[model samples]
Target: MTWQLRRAHEADLEAIMHLETITFVHDAWSPTMMARDLGDPACFYLVAFPPDEPSAVEGYAGLLAPRGAVEGDIQTIAVAESARGRGLGRTLMQALINEARKRGARLIFLEVRADNPGAQRLYERLGFIEVGVRRGYYQPDNVDAIVMRLDIPELESMLVETS
Candidate 1:
């Protein structure tokens, strides 16, 4: 399957929100919060469109990397259920990692729900290491969060090997 990734624009808000809501369900961010993050200069947001449906978004991801910062954070990433198992999540994650590298980040951090072994495996495949854990980080469901960190240099090498 072919797809394209590009920086998100204001016009894609509704589609992004739709995917985000469905993908994250009870833990989804509010439209207001998403809008704020999308507009923030320190944030890099991207959306992926499948080849057959160029105008339709299949996934989206975001990163927080301040200018000249040594560290960055994966703010969010999600692929539509229909789009899963097609490498959409990996593509979105790679995009965020590249953006973080470009912004001078030496390391990137992210938290995945403890129950999400699929996501954890993906991150591990991309060279992320388990750093710590946040107990009951995900509210309502009371899911623990597994903190992961990826060193930029290691990530770069991993990307090269995969490519």
Candidate 2:
């Protein structure tokens, strides 16, 4: 289950879109929206693929870290169902966090569906704490969103000790 992560490119749009449709169904971003995000200079996107099959995208994630900003956001993250439980989500999260740290972000934030406790637990393990809740934030599905934040310095300290 060795996978390599690299910056996402336009050529990955199809695979990423497919994964997004399956992963977020009712909440999936349109291809056009995804394209705009991909083109934004303030955002960073990465896609994961198996080394032996470069065209097979297993997952993708994006981060928004505007230049000189102290805060960043996890725009999106998803792993193909087949890729779950292999730590791909963790890997994508760590990559986003590391990128935020590199960009001098003091805090990182994200909103996860309230119903997704698994994702919440993963964020917790990565040092994010619930900061707020947005009721009915995810439309159609009418799902609440849990806002979470992580203090970059605190996360760095935790990582330091663990390493």
Candidate 2 at 142: error in angstroms? 0.6
Worst 10-residue lDDT window, candidate 1: 154-163
Error of 1 at 32 (Å): 0.6
What is the Å distance of residue 86 in model 1 from its true position?
1.5
* Candidate 1 structure quality by residue, lDDT tens digits, 72-92: 999999888888888988988
Model 2 residue-pair collision total: 0
Instruction: Tell me each candidate's TM-score.
Output: 0.92, 0.94
Model 2: worst 10 consecutive residues (lDDT sum): 154-163
Candidate that scores best on TM-score: 2
Model 2 spans > 4 angstroms off: 154-163
Candidate 1 local lDDT, residue 69: 100
> How does each model score on lDDT?
0.90, 0.93
Q: Model 2: per-residue lDDT, tens digit, 119-154?
A: 999999988999999999999999999999998865
